[model samples]
Target: MQPVLRQLPAGALLFHRNAPAYGIFRLVTGRVRLERVTPDGTTVPVHTVRPGELFAEASLFSSCYHCDARVVHDAELHFYPRTALVARFRGDPNALFDFAAGLARRVQGLRTRLEVRQVRAAAERLLLFLRLQVDAGRFYRPEGTWKDVAEEIGLTHEALYRALAKLEATGRIERLRGAVRVLRTRPG
Candidate 1:
């Protein structure tokens, strides 16, 4: 990974429209807010990328950032330059495979964005967001706060807390010390 260090405050933009595509970043700590604005000036917040996720990969092939990426909370990232990434794939087939996997994940993230936009009900949106938050059948980080979940599901913090409590009380998740454990869902 290309080594770049920056400490951004909440809502600090990491990338802007037409910004140079220097590299891809691996989240080391904190939260990143993915935001896109429509031509009509409507802002759509896609999600807050957690640690262990990659952001701004679109810059790899494109010359400019298509949207804005901001930090929802303080964050640390490892930036891998575009040239280094391109070179890695050029040398080994496995590197190419890894790149493909990463690209696939970006596509899935976009799909989730579309789904969120399509759903009309906030409750449904919250449920879908929670489901996607799972990794390998478990919540990725129980350390996530109600604010994180609220932003992801596009709900108010109070509403998110209520929704989460409802899910928890129903045995869909268990509230732990610092995280919530996802209980298995029933097959629809």
Candidate 2:
């Protein structure tokens, strides 16, 4: 089946929690955030899907979405119907293997994020995230705002600002226009 193309603006919801899962999506551009609304009515961010990434893969086997998928930036995506994809997977062993491999990698990344979130100190948490996620030059470029990075690292926006200030003051990191350059591994 040919995938359906969709264009959505920021704040548009692609799907709601408990919504029937008909298909999976591949983001061609922009950002989509997966959030779970708690019993207390608080929205908790689960994950952010970037361009070139596929989301709601579990929907291929599940009956409904586990969380809400909201567009955080104007986005373009391709929707692949689950039935057709599953049929292709069954017929193509290699396709199934590749999909499973991608899932495993995503799981590993989630584990790392969880570990970073478990750190108590905001500065320490931010430092650990940079250390783990930075490129070879030890620079971590945020895909969104500092608030988004704060959310990803399980810190309040104020706390993230304070942590960045502390890190910069201590000469542990350099805050560039759109990136954080890690000068050291730990607070000095």
Candidate 3:
């Protein structure tokens, strides 16, 4: 089945929490942020989907979306209907296996993020998160501000600022206008 194409302007809410799960989305261009709002009205960021990545996969089997997905930039996306994809997977073992593998990778990423957030030291958490982002090529030209990163890493924005300041003072990273560049250490 042909995936349906969608174009959304920045700040558009693709779906809200508890909404029925119609399909999963593949980001062809631009960025998307998945977030959940707490009962106290706090917004907790879940993940940021970049180009070429599929998001909301968990919604495929679920009745509803676990979080709200919003466009962070003007975006072009392809919506793959869950029902159609499941039907195809039933007839194709290779397709089912590949889809499972992608879901496994996403689970592993979330596990690693959980471990990083468990670190008691805010600086350590920031450093680890930054390293992970750098490894993913998402650090240098970050899609959102440090505040958004703080939410993703489960830290307060003030704490993130403090950690960045410490890292900057130690010359571990260079802070540009809207980016953070990790500096390479010289071997003695």
TM for candidate 3 is 0.59
Per-residue error for 126 in candidate 3, Å, reads 11
Candidate 2 lDDT (Cα, whole model)? 0.89
User: Model 1 compared with the native: what TM-score?
Assistant: 0.60
Name the best candidate (by lDDT).
Answer: 2
Q: For residues 1-188, could you state the per-residue lDDT of candidate 3 as single tens digits? A: 68999999999999999999989999999999999999999999998897888888889889999999999999999999988998898999899999899889988988998989888888878877778778532447667667778887888999989998998898888888878877776779
| TM-score of each prediction | 0.60, 0.70, 0.59
Per-residue accuracy of model 2 over 1-188 as CA lDDT, tens digit each: 58899999999999998999989999999999999999999999998897888899988899899999999999999999988899999999998999899999989988998899899999989988888877435678887788889888889999999999998998888988878898845437
Candidate 2: pairs in clash:
none
**Model 1 ranges off by over 4 Å:** 1-16, 30-51, 67-74, 127-143, 164-188
lDDT-best of 1 and 3? 3
Give per-residue CA lDDT, model 1, range 83-115, as digits (tens): 888788788889789888978888887788778
Deviation in Å, model 2, residue 83 alpha carbon = 1.4
Ranking by TM-score: 2, 1, 3
